[model samples]
Target: MDYFLQLVLNGLFVGAFYALVALGYTMVYGIIKLLNFAHGDIYMVGGFVGFTMLTAASGAMGAKGGLLLLIVVMVLAMLTTGTLGLIIERIAYRPLRGAPRLSILITAVGASFALEYGIALAYGPNPRAYPVGMGTGSFNVFGVRISTGQLVMVVIAVILMIALDTLVRRTRSGRAMRAISQDPRACLLMGVNVDSVIARTFFLGSALAGAAGVMAGAYYGKIDFLMGFIIGLKAFTAAVIGGIGNIRGAVLGAIVLGLLESFGTAWLGSQWRDVFAFGFLILFLTVRPTGLLGERVTERV
Candidate 1:
């Protein structure tokens, strides 16, 4: 029972991170119908930015600047990455908007590879340890040990998801975004700036990925150029599982994937963990390809 509780708690944390990152992929897919493969690199960039800031802070203020400086770095990185997302849309994606989907997809793949290799060149081909000010202390919940960092991460993820859900459903900008997503031509006729709306969506998604980057840096304690690849794949899987293009679906998918991975790793041994998890995904897809809450989309004749 204790072990089960521990796994559940840990799964929640992993889910939070996955959900946050998956938001980027699913949102862009919803609005643009493009995968935005470079999203993982955006996440990678955020991690590196935060890492550099932490190294500088530690050098200047030692342990004294630990918590406060970390906060500043995260905020800066998020804002930077958000802006970067806008530029990426404008530069790499917008120009190809009217092009063939295959062309745009190849371009996206190229962009992703460029970002990855660029980071490798800049940061070198090595993993850097993330500095943390927090000590490992936990609250005992029915013989389950849960740490402050894990709890904080989960809370932050939930709050951000709620905030994003509200932004999309309740706000005027969000309405414009939805209109654009449904039919960009109609949205344009209705005086909605489709390009701006798309940029904003990317900004929001990238910002969330940035936050995930910081949280990962704090908890996982390592940063590498290729770090985002595997996790990005997992997050993409989560988005698909939840219902691509649906915010709540992404969150739901993430939790299920996290729980599945956690339990599989613990019970079946680490070697078969990913295989088992993806195998379950395949089975789920066979039954319900649209995912838990996904809408049935039809093609126009």
Candidate 2:
């Protein structure tokens, strides 16, 4: 039972990270029907930014300031990545909005490679160690132990997710996003600033990814330029599983995928985790194409 609890806890943390990144995937897909494969690279950028900030701060504030440094660095990284996301949208995606889907997809792939290799060239090909030590202590709940870092991370992630959910569901910009997603042409015709809304969506989604990246680095204690590649695919899988265009579904799918991977790895060893994840994706696609919450709808007429 303790082992089960441990796995569940781990799954929830992993799921939160997945959900954060998956929101970016789902948002872009929902609004533009374009899968921004380079989105994961933005997460990597955030991790690097946080790492740089923390390293710089450690010199001034010492190791005791880890918590404070984390908060400040995370916010900075989010802003940085959010701007990068906006720039990428303007330079890469916007131009291809009217182009063929294949062209835009190829461009996304190119952008992904560009980001990966660009970071590798700048930071070297090896993995960079996160500066701060995050494994400080643990707390017990009902005989189950949870690390301080994990607890903090989970709480931060939940807060961010809730905030984002509210923003999308309650805010004017969110209404604009939904409108654009449903019908960009109609939204434009209805006097909505479609481009501005899409840009904001990218900004918010990328900021969440950036925040997740920072937390991942803090928890995992290491990061690399190529770290976002596999995780990006996993996040995309989560988005698909939850219904690619649905915000809430993305969160649900990510948690489900994370739980599946967590238990599967425990049962079959870590090497088989990806295999299990992909297997589930295949099953979901074949069995229920619309996903858990996706509604079937025909093209707008």
Candidate 3:
């Protein structure tokens, strides 16, 4: 029972990270219906950016001013990653919007490689140590040990999820996004700037992923160029498990994936962690392609 509780705690903590990365994929799919394969790489970039900002600040202010410096770094990371997302949409995706899905898919693959090598050149092909200095303490609840860092990460993920959910459910932009998702041509006819909305969607998704990258860097204490790949893959599985294009589904999927993976690791050993998670993903897709909460989508033809 104690071990079970510990696994549950660890799973929830990891799920928060998955949810953050999944948001970018779901949001982009929501508006554009294109799987931005480069999104995973965008997340990797966010970690590096946060790492640089955090390290530079740590040098200047020492651990005493960590909170203030962290806040500033967070803002910079969100802005930088958000802007990069918009640019990627415009420069990489926009031109191919009306083209075949195959063409856009290839473009996404190219963009992914470009971002990866670009970062490797700029940062060098070495793992960088993430700055430490976040909260440090642990409390036991019913024999489940929980650390302050995990607690903070879970809270931050929740805040981001709530803020995003509210914005999607309540705002005019949200309405526009939904309309475009349903019928982009109709939205354009209704005088909604479909292009701009898609751009904003990319920005929001990338910004959230960036924030998650920051949290992950803090928690894990190290980062690399390919850090987002495995997590991103899991998050996509989560999105698929819940319903790929649904925001609510992404969150639900993330929690389920996190808990399941955590339990799988505990029961089946760490070596088979990914294999188990991915096996479930394949099984789910084969059995129920629409996912747990996903609406059934049909081809136009």
Q: Top TM-score: which candidate number?
A: 2
Tens digit per residue, CA lDDT, model 1, 1-301: 8999899987888888899999998899889888788888788888988888877888877554555566688888899889988988899999998899999889888888888899899989999888654345679889988887787778778888999999999999889877877799999999988999999999999998987888788878888988778777787788889988877898899999999989999988989877976886787678777878799968877
In angstroms, give how far residue 121 of model 2 lies from its true place: 1.2
For every model shown, what is its TM-score relative to the native structure? Answer: 0.95, 0.97, 0.96
Q: After superposition, how far is residue 170 of candidate 3 from its true place, in Å?
A: 0.3
Residue pairs in collision within model 2: none
Ranking by lDDT: 2, 3, 1
Model 3 lDDT per residue over 176-280, tens place = 998898999999899999999999899999998888877777778778888877877888899899899899999989989999989998888999999988998
The TM-score of predicted model 1 comes to: 0.95
lDDT of 3 at 34: 84
Better structure of 2 and 3 per TM-score: 2
Instruction: Candidate 2: list runs displaced more than 4 Å.
Output: none
Error of 3 at 291 (Å): 0.7
**lDDT value for candidate 3?**
0.85
Ranking by TM-score: 2, 3, 1
Clashes of 3: 0
